[model samples]
Target: MSTTVTQQPQHSTLGECKRWLRVSLYTIFLLTGQCTATLLGRFYFDKGGKSKWIATSVQSAGFPILIPLLFYSSKSTNHDSSKIKRKRSVMFTLYLGFGLMMIAMDFLYSCGLSYLPLSTFALVCATQLAFNGVATYFLNSQKFTALTLNAIVVLTMSVILIALNTESEDSKDLPKEKLLIGFFCALAASATFALHHSLLQLYFVKVAETGAFSALVRLNFYPMFIATVGGVVGLLGSGDWRSMGKEMKEFEYGRVSYVMTLVWTAATWQIACIGMLGLIFEVSSLFSVVVGNLELTIAPILGVFVFHDKIYGVKIVAFLLAIWGFLSYIYQHYLDDRMANQDKSDDGLQVSKGEEQI
Candidate 1:
């Protein structure tokens, strides 16, 4: 006679529930930070603001945000196994490469934003999702199942629709040449953003053995430190530093208010990144993108109020298409979760069968 001993499953308590709660909150925070940066930048640029160097300062804000994480990472003790993992996972050169790529992505996206209106720029930036999908597949060998394909196609179509809407809306006001320039720069920015993020995802999945939050710290503090320095160099190259204070003082809001906006925007930017890193840590990059895209909905709505953006019928249609694509992607995530649960159940059943035979 064989006695089968069944193991009790681990109970998910309030802590686990709170983890998801935090994820949702973090998503909101990320979106808010992005909106803050975009709007404040618009405010500055719209009113005779001409400091590309400020863009350099904004991204490097990640340097200071990593301060707490530095302490956190230092506290983590690696075991022998983890040490081996680190040896296999980390390459200093790779981190440096990521930072360099970031310099291009940051500078290009800033150029796009500087030229295009907020709503139009946001619409153009949506293409990054499609770029990220392609990059993830190539870089991480992430599979594209039918559901993924459906969502991606929908998103692609939505972006096309948004571009059409942009053409019809305010392209007349902006110089045709500058509009084209913004479009191309935004596209390039999307591409670089995709490559940088995909590489980071690879780094985390393959090499980083630390906990999510710890890895988050390292991602910002390490690659971002170099990226920030590169930005400073880029700023210096542009010869914008000497006139930065002059530009700040001349801002319509007064120097104190302008300085305050930068500080506030920088703080929001850091919080937003923390939220993004948190989501990427808790979930996945694709999921983080979905959460990030939710900003598209928010930014335009806020743009109406802040930038006095006029939303026409074509934009409405584009907005609807965006919602459709987002829903499709979200449904895909649900399908993935269900399939994962089914696999676990099948494994449990197989184990039970073996126990019965014993």
Candidate 2:
């Protein structure tokens, strides 16, 4: 008789709780990276040159590279063997639609910044929470609870207060049409962002069972491609093709040594940050929207000290209120999770008792 070998089951290197903690930390880091990149963009613009173009170019530079790296990393860990078999035409259409929406968002946002102050921009962009909520309700069938409504009101009020109290650097009056355009553009961008969020979620479910890397890469591939195209088109259309040439020549000479180094650095950070956001969104529930929008609250407070920006006591109070509201939201989520776990444990006990009776 031949002896047979039995392999012992190996314990997971990381526990589920530890994995969750890692994800939470990574999510926080992603948000911090985004905030840092935003600060870097502000610095790049302050250093002179075309602020808008510099911000765009630098942000674009790193994302194209980081997305692929992170995506491949995610892919390596995924165990799902299923293939996505959607027709090329359909997939291209989805990607193109999403890409164009994002492109429009970027274009409109940059144009808006040309008119509005940073404070105004931040306040307006905060409405993304509202847009995200609405989109989730319609697209994902997530129930709209009273807490969500209350949170929205609190956050909206906070943003309005912040906007009203924001100090302007220029005492001179801005053009009425430009201001209107800026406000509308910013709102449009927020709406588009909401759509982008939902679309990416659906895409994650459809094309990738495990969205660790493939999900991130697929999302960025079209958006970056479109953004690159938009940048090129904008550069050409503005008759500043020379600026494009100059940036490229600088990159060729030694991208790191170029004056656009800050731009490139910011871009890299942005890509990583966004990729992190996508990953978190894929894994978390609706509260992730709340957490993401809280970036508005975090960025401004730091900006006041870091960028010499100013915020009034009223706005600070409003931000605190918003923070309270978000905290309440998180507390509610914790309670729900606790109750759910309890129910699950009780069900297991009932099943065991039924089996004993049998």
Q: Whose lDDT is greatest here? A: 1
Worst 10 residues of 2 by lDDT: 1-10
Q: Give the TM-score of candidate 2.
A: 0.78
Candidate 2 residue-wise lDDT, 36-124, digit = tens: 76666565445434545545545544555566565576667655333344355666787777667766777777767667787688778
> Per-residue lDDT of 1-358 in model 1, one digit per residue for the tens?
1222233122223444566687778787787888787777667677757877676567655467668768867678454676755664445677688778877788888888778865577667887888888888788776777766766666555555555655555543678899899889988998787777677777778877767667777676767778878888877888888887888768887888877776776777777777777776666666667667656655665777788887667556656766776677667766765586567656766777887798
- How many residue pairs clash in all the candidates, one count each? 1, 2
- Top of the candidates by TM-score: 1
TM-score of 1: 0.84
Weakest ten-residue segment in model 1 by summed lDDT: 1-10
Cα misplacement distance, residue 43 of candidate 1 (Å):
1.7
